[model samples]
Target chain A: MGLAKRIIPCLDVDNGRVVKGVQFVDIRDAGDPVEIAKRYDQQGADELTFLDITATHDNRDTIVHVVEAVASQVFIPLTVGGGIRQLADIRRMLNAGADKVGINSAAISNPEFVREAAEKFGSQCIVVAIDAKRVSDQDEADKWEIFTHGGRKPTGIDAVEWAKKMVTYGGGEILLTSMDRDGTKSGFDLALTRAVSQAVNVPVIASGGVGELQDLTDGVKLGEADAVLAASIFHFGEHTVGEAKQQMARQGIEVRL
Target chain B: MRHVAVIDYGMGNLRSVSKALETVSESAEIHITSDPKHILDADHIVFPGVGAMRDCVSELRRLGLDDVIREASQTKPFLGICLGMQALLSYSEENNGVTALDIVPGQVRHFDTQRERSGNDFKVPHMGWNEVRQNISHPLWQKIDDASRFYFVHSFYVDPTDAGVIAGTSRYQHEFSAALSQENVFAVQFHPEKSQSAGLQLLKNFLNWDGQS
Candidate 1:
């Protein structure tokens, strides 16, 4: 089979509502998660990833219902993350028709969960999301650190090495998000993306800093990412999947138009 | 009233296919039914799939819609999309020690990039738009232009034993058949619903097809 380029729109659901932000600042509501998901699915989005970014403390049931509602209407793959701390959470999400479950803070807090989840539900079901921030100091040159709690805390783990380890521990895929470039509209962190892509054998989705079509092209061409994920550009009507695929085709990147 | 019963075998994308049909024929009644009687009574049938070929074929068997589909195909119109198209073939390499619907005399094989060194840069599953080149004309291609883009997401391609059934072709690293039509049977590797205007037009032609008449 040929490698398929996936175009995913990340929905940051805060308390059952979809929101978009940069560096977790200037947060603005987008729309209803179920409504937006159906619209994206109609617009030809390959997959949908829901990140419960509200720092869920007591609203787990609401998020689960949101996932269930969206899954019922949207036939495509639904991936749920955010506040996913335990195997039970993963089970709830999967039972709610989630094809995959993404774990970021939980995976870092206890890396064993990644392996255990893989063993229980199979390797192709668990995804380890790595939110990384670039360190600028010359002494810390070429270093990428993992961030937790919605990019609020640094995990002190090297992004590339952590990604390699995640795959080794049976993590299905790696979602590499560049916190520094996120919401900057500059582009994906190609350096970090390339490092992780080369370090891991599994598929890597390049997220953050996608403002223009070229950024997507760069993510696929230079970063060697399996997929290019964006929020604002797709959410705010800046570009559609058809337009993105048109641009990817111009750059010779295969995308389902 | 022309009714198109889309067999919902619980293994395919029925909504998108139904929506595409709705766009084509205003009177096209799309029923997502697993009942063999509904399929046998329908004027036409469309099988849309996305998942394992074995599971899809098995679901059709478990539901006992195989004979109904075959019977309808002999006298009415039949269209298969993606895995639905693959399911119509003899067998697939996905599930070991299994047989497919065998409606078409061919096997589905994985896209061999290593044999042909041209698709090294492009990944597998080939999810995107590639131009469809017409090899032979069928009613489905009535209004569609040559080289019109269509959406496709599949890892394997169909290799039919009967070359005359090949109706359309597309290329990634190597050229392969994209659409096939034999008698009343029509199938395409691409998703017509997701293919936009060109795809909608193809669906429209299929709705207006007077093959039986």
Candidate 2:
């Protein structure tokens, strides 16, 4: 393994503008995905992940064009997720200059889809994006379960165990997001990250709940995640990638500074 | 007019490379042309790629840009990025067979998984930012310090046969050649355009480089 711990900036693109509506709803214009992606790349971001929040409803061509436009400007590795369900979608994204394709709902519906896509495009190209939310139970045995449809529906599946299964099913990497921590400006769920990182053999990118620079460091050092991803912090000019990396280095974490 | 012809064989992110060059040069002309004449006529040439090594080499040969590149490297400044750098080597271990390029002496081999395994479960493709330790002094490293960070995204690396040509080295799981220079021919496995400040400095250094006549 030669890859370093990536510091990725995620973008939720809705109609070509980066938007952050509550729980992925009533999305308003945040900014252009291309402009935001270029800004992150310019700030020394390791990689960029673009989630087409409305791709499923808009169709494949729209996403492909957006990806093409983004790829034309940015040179770093770009991973496109959301509404990538079929082989054709994967191929289209790849052809449009996406280095990796992330699947979430499709993999949940069909576990074998991971293996099938990995077999077709190689494991390096497939990324499994897991959206999980913590559930409380009176039985005291309740745990976090996987959520689908933009974290709208619960699959009643244990996220930790499901992550392990995802890797076994040929997921090259895991992008774990905590629905509870998302957009909270509190911090990342270190426990959830550690559990998923321990369960998967491939690289695990800890997503959701990156309030400050220390959260990123804790996510990498304490959570043992291969990468740390944040959205609002970066999009809202809270912190640049270089600033976060400098903080990580100060905390005795090995980063490319 | 000082023009920089960026060889675009339909395999690279040339726009970023061109943008980086434009930032550094006062009169940098970025021409994404496959024509051999444009490559031969340019003041400098930058070969940029992010796709398969074999595909790029084959495309270069198909376009008869192989001879053009070979001729251009003799007098003009030539820099290869990522897969373009791999194509500058003698051969690559991709596509289940050895496709020879004969640009450099050594063969480009896939990263040794057995030898370069990290304890924390590192990923392949080596995507992201990493530091490059300067091994030899060259015009490219004019203002760059030791262990300068650079962005890399590749599965293969160059093994220069001549030690004198190696300019900088980086460690992933093990030490590997990150930047190489042999006369006017320079290559880097990392993408300087994507590397931000450090990368911009490198591009500026290259633009101001007075080594190649």
Candidate 3:
């Protein structure tokens, strides 16, 4: 059977409330996490991811409660990310009913932690999130560089190289988010997504800059991503998950409708 | 009230499986336990597992649940998921040839088909939703539609020796058994608990099924 391209609706949670922001700042509350997640589940979302944007010590417990509430109501797979610094943090999310734990800043800070988490809790449950930005003419030597701390600090690490390393280190999946395109609603960074998707042996999820249904199809076709993730379009009800899927099918892309 | 025992050897996600079973039944009792007595005495047993084969095999032997599982398979309705399905085989290529429960005569092998042959550079871990084509009529496939997509996350695939036991097949780079049915035992390589509507229907059907084929 051919694997169907997945449509994922991501929720950014801050202090127990589902929120949306532009480029990780200027946050605004969307709705309750559980309520939003249930709606996506009903709309035939293949999976749901909850990103704890706060990523602070005090807000950690809040994310756990949010994950628990959402998991109870939504039967689809749930991925929890943000502030997953250590094994304990990953354990906390999984114990709270998260099917997978996504590591971003923590993975960049300590790359070996990705392998450790993958080994401890099978690679199937470990997702490495890479936030990258394309370099301009000034840095001709590098096309893309890794960014940490919500795309604020830039590392010299190459995005494509980092993606290959994450997979070799046993990352089951890669969630590649483009800093240049995130929240812009332009479209996914097809060049970057294609490079990383070809570089890894696991599934790559193209995220950021998805404004229309065409972007979803482009992500799977041009970007070669196994899945496409978006927040604003789905959270605001611009297009339902069914509509996006119908558009994908019309474009000759296999999607579970 | 039918009591379903989800055999837990501390390997995979039991919460989602238990929660889904609870959602499917109003009067049935779902218990996640590693105790041998609870499994043997339960009306139905569901074996669920994930992670490495070496660890899974060791845990089952350490808890002495391997023998208990063997006995319960013959006495009641049994359902295995993911690694739990792999463990029912005779041996696995994973963990450098680990011996399994030998409940079913089969071997688990890694999907080594090259991309050049399939024309698609399919990734290993074969992670995501794929369609399961049913091969035979069974009670477990009751309300669920044929060729329904189920969520899968695994690197190895089981090849049962007897073709008669093969109940359903799925494609990766090539076709492999997705569901196996033998006597009172039925197992699947995908996670029905996470498959949404179609998966819920399968769980509900299992709750209402008897041990008979």
Number of the top candidate by DockQ? 3
- The TM-score of candidate 2 is 0.79
- Candidate 3 residue pairs in backbone clash: A1-B171
Candidate 3 DockQ, CA atoms: 0.65
Q: What local lDDT does model 2 show for residue A224?
A: 86
Deviation in Å, model 1, residue B171 alpha carbon: 2.3
What's the TM-score of every candidate structure? 0.73, 0.79, 0.96
Give the runs in model 2 whose Cα sits over 4 Å from its true position. A1-4, A21-44, A55-79, A84-103, A106-127, A132-146, A153-173, A184-186, A195-202, A234-243, B114-118, B208-213
Q: List model 2 lDDT by residue over A1-257, tens digit each.
A: 23456789888777665677312122243366776677777777888898887745745466777777877677677899988888888878876768789999999898888888876666667899999988866577536899987689989899999988987776778899999898887888887898787666567899988899899999999888889998877766667899998888787777765
Better of 2 and 3 by DockQ: 3
Q: What value does the interface RMSD of model 1 take? A: 6.5
Q: How well is each residue in B61-86 modelled by candidate 1, as lDDT tens digits?
A: 88898887778778888888888888
Note the DockQ of each predicted structure.
0.10, 0.23, 0.65
Q: A206, model 3: CA deviation in Å?
A: 0.1
Model 2, position A79, has a per-residue lDDT of 91
lDDT of each: 0.78, 0.78, 0.88
Q: Which pairs of residues clash in candidate 1, taking residues 3 or more apart in a chain or in different chains?
A: A2-B123, A2-B124, A2-B125, A3-B123, A3-B124, A3-B125, A255-B128, A256-B128
Q: Give one digit per residue, the lDDT tens place, for model 3 in B1-213.
A: 788999989886788889899998878999999999888989999999889998999999999999999999998989999999999999999978999999999999998634652244468888888999989989999877898999988999999999899989999888999999999999999998889998888888888889687
Classify candidate 3 by CAPRI docking class.
medium
Residue A188, candidate 3: Cα error in Å is: 0.4
TM-score: which is higher, 2 or 3? Answer: 3
